[model samples]
Target chain A: MQIVVDLNRCQGYAQCAFLAPQVFELHGEEALMFTPAVPDDQRERVHRAAAACPVQAIVVGERAGPGVR
Target chain B: MQPDTLFQRITDYANRADPYPLYAELRENGVTRQDDGSYLVGTYHEIAALLHDPRISSDYRSRTHPDEAMIRRNERPPSFIGLDDPEHDRLRRIAMRPFGPPHSPGRIDELHGDITRIAEELIDAFRGADRIDIVDEFAYPLPVTVICRLLGVPHEDVPRIRAWTNAIIDSFDFTPGADQEKRQQAGLDARDAMARYLGELAGGRRGHPSEDMLSALVNDAGPEGRLTDVELMATATLLLIAGHETTVNLITNGVLTLLRHPDAHKRLRDEPGLMPRAVEELLRYEPPVHMLPQRTPLADIEVAGVTVPKGAPLILMLASGNRDPLRFDDPDRFDPEREDNQHFGFGSGIHNCFGAPLARLETQIALGALLPYLDDFHLLDDPPPYRRSPLLRGPRHLLIARG
Candidate 1:
């Protein structure tokens, strides 16, 4: 699955960091530095991180799972 | 008549054990327009939509104060959780730095061990007592202590903090015929007192730096970094109340619900790994903050074919949303393993419970420790008396057997 974060909309709330720190890294000034895609092994952690996003900014896609539609 | 204006039934003390029946009745009508012109979104889908909608404001004052009528005549500003964008964004960011990431990453998650120790200590105390009140003994102290330690609140001052927080939160009860003026004034006084106390703490930190949240706010980098005195008080007041009351309910409710449903507790005891999932279910089935009432519509918005007029008062029932059948299978039933369960135990969206990680860790270790130690236990009384608040629901006292 893949993840996407629109930095423009991101206020650096760091809620994403609270969820999945490994995937979402916040630097000084709360700027988000992150991994856009997760390998099959890290899918679980990625999904958790996505759920944790308060803004729902992190969008995740399935590699070969249920369709978004 | 549908009793449209009669919110009294919603507050019926008889419905305390299971207010779901009344909530279900409200949903049958799709929406209940109150006498005060506010709309209570009891339906599952509607609350979910409102919570997700950016236009819905979490600021309670915005919803309740039409003319910005203070919940109290003498009150400072509220925490960012009760605020809107730009300003809410700014305060919440600065506040988040010391406790959470970009500045202090993994602070909450790292407290797992300390929380576990705290839980064990509480459990150790319960070893000799055959019957105990979970609220007073375990649930109450654990969260309050953690918040105190994390925020650098003095242990001596915790009782005062608790009293102030309780006074403010007490005013949030939606009980019909409550003295509006008295409630508002008390809520205000409590908040004001909390701010003053926290401010003093912050001032002390200025001369002497320490390893605490108050000190961090005092010793910020630049103009943008520091919080004004008012801002610090408001923010600290938020943490204090949010710290003291919320998790106590979570812990108490978890134990009560589990004891109520022995099958679940037995399963959890058999498999400790399920503690986390069980906590999630507890959040859904019986959340700490049941229905957060401060969501005001930013503009006219259509939710489930019902148009919520712009600037109209909106009540986002988080509890109702969690039980929406559309969201979960047999939503009423508490199933820890129920996957795809994105419940709003904590406030969802931007203002989701900031202390969720702390709350979760505390409950997990708490329930975990109690599950085993409570070899054979049962509720002291069925339908235990509950606190007088619908927004924050939990038993007034949950006496359970140990031996």
Candidate 2:
């Protein structure tokens, strides 16, 4: 699975990072860094993170393409 | 049939103890337009969507009928919570720097030992006591001290600061009263006074940096530029109030719920690892904040098939959505181990509770510390007297006694 985070939309609530730290990391207050390609073991965590994103900035699965809403 | 009084009834002091029934009625009614011309959105999905929608404005000035009090408040700069982005975003980010990650990553975590120590100390004061008022002795003081220590405010000033906070919060009462104007003016006056006090406090730390948030904020020279004097005052006051006010309710409400559900309380005490999840459940089951009373729509937005006209007062029933059967399985049940618990306890979207990490840690430690003593604790008042504001609903005092 792949993930796409709309950095513009992300407010760095860090819900994603809290749920899936390995997949998503917040560098500073607002800068969010994430692993785009999810490991099989991390698939569940990534899905949870996406759903838990306060701004809905995280997109996962095959539909996770650049500039995709 | 008379006009729908669901919103009115929900805000009524009589229903303050449990507004869940009215909320269920609201969800059944979908997006409801009250006689007062405001709209109430109670369903889980709709409230969640509106919360995320930028079209929903948090600024009270956007209301269709901006009153004298609101205009008076306008004289002072709006805090980040009341402003829209990029202004809100900017102030919030600057405020976040000293509180949490990635900057000051250990800020909240560093408070763990202090929080535990504080909770234990508060509990220790309960020694040889047959009864306790959780709100007064335990819940209120713990967060107040933690926030004061974090903000660099002298602990001696808490009584004065709390007076200002009370006045400000009392101004938010939704129920129409004869002294509404008086209350509003007092709220504004209190805000100004509090801001002045906070400004002086922050001013003292301007050049010489200290360990507290106010010091960091006043001395900050990040790329975002420093907060103006007014901004610093507003931001500092916001942190101080937000740090303690809601947290007091969270701790009080958590203890109240646990005492009501002894089985859950026992389970929690038996397995302390469930403390975090139990806190989340407490947020969902009996959240500190019950509603967002000041939201306005920037545009005519269709919600649940009803179009909420622009500038109309939009009250989001967060606690209602937490119990919406459509959202959670057995929404009324207090299940600590429940998963997929994305609750509005801290709210969601851009204006989500900034002090959530600290609040969570505080509550968990508080409840964990008090769990052992709760085995013999019984509620002195089942539906305890609630606070005045329905928006920030919780018991004003939770009297518990040893069996």
Model 2: residue B234 alpha-carbon error in angstroms = 1.0
* Structure candidate 2, residue pairs in collision: A28-B102
Over the stretch B24-128, how does candidate 2's per-residue lDDT look in tens digits? 898998898888798988889998999889999999878889766677887889999999999998998888778766666657656768988988898889966
**lDDT, residue B270, model 2:** 92
- Model 1 chain B poorest ten-residue lDDT run: B67-76
Candidate 2 residue runs with Cα over 4 Å from true position:
A1-11, A15-25, A28-69, B1-4
lDDT digits (tens) for residues B1-403 of candidate 1: 2333545666655667788777666767777667777787876667766766788876655553463343443245667877888888888778877887767777776676788888888878877888899998899989898898989988898789878877787777665454866776787877788888889988988968898888888886543578888888888888878875888999898888887787888899898867766777888898888787667887777876778777777777777777777667898898877665567888666777777766776787788888876668788888888987877878889888754
Cα deviation at B202, candidate 2, in Å, is: 0.6
**What TM-score, computed on C-alpha atoms, does each candidate reach?**
0.86, 0.88
Q: After superposition, how far is residue A52 of candidate 1 from its true place, in Å?
A: 6.4
Candidate number achieving the greatest DockQ relative to the actual structure: 1
Q: In model 1, what are the clashing residue pairs, if there are any?
A: none
Question: Fnat per model, in the order given?
Answer: 0.39, 0.11
DockQ of each: 0.29, 0.14
Task: Find the candidate with the highest TM-score and give its number.
Answer: 2
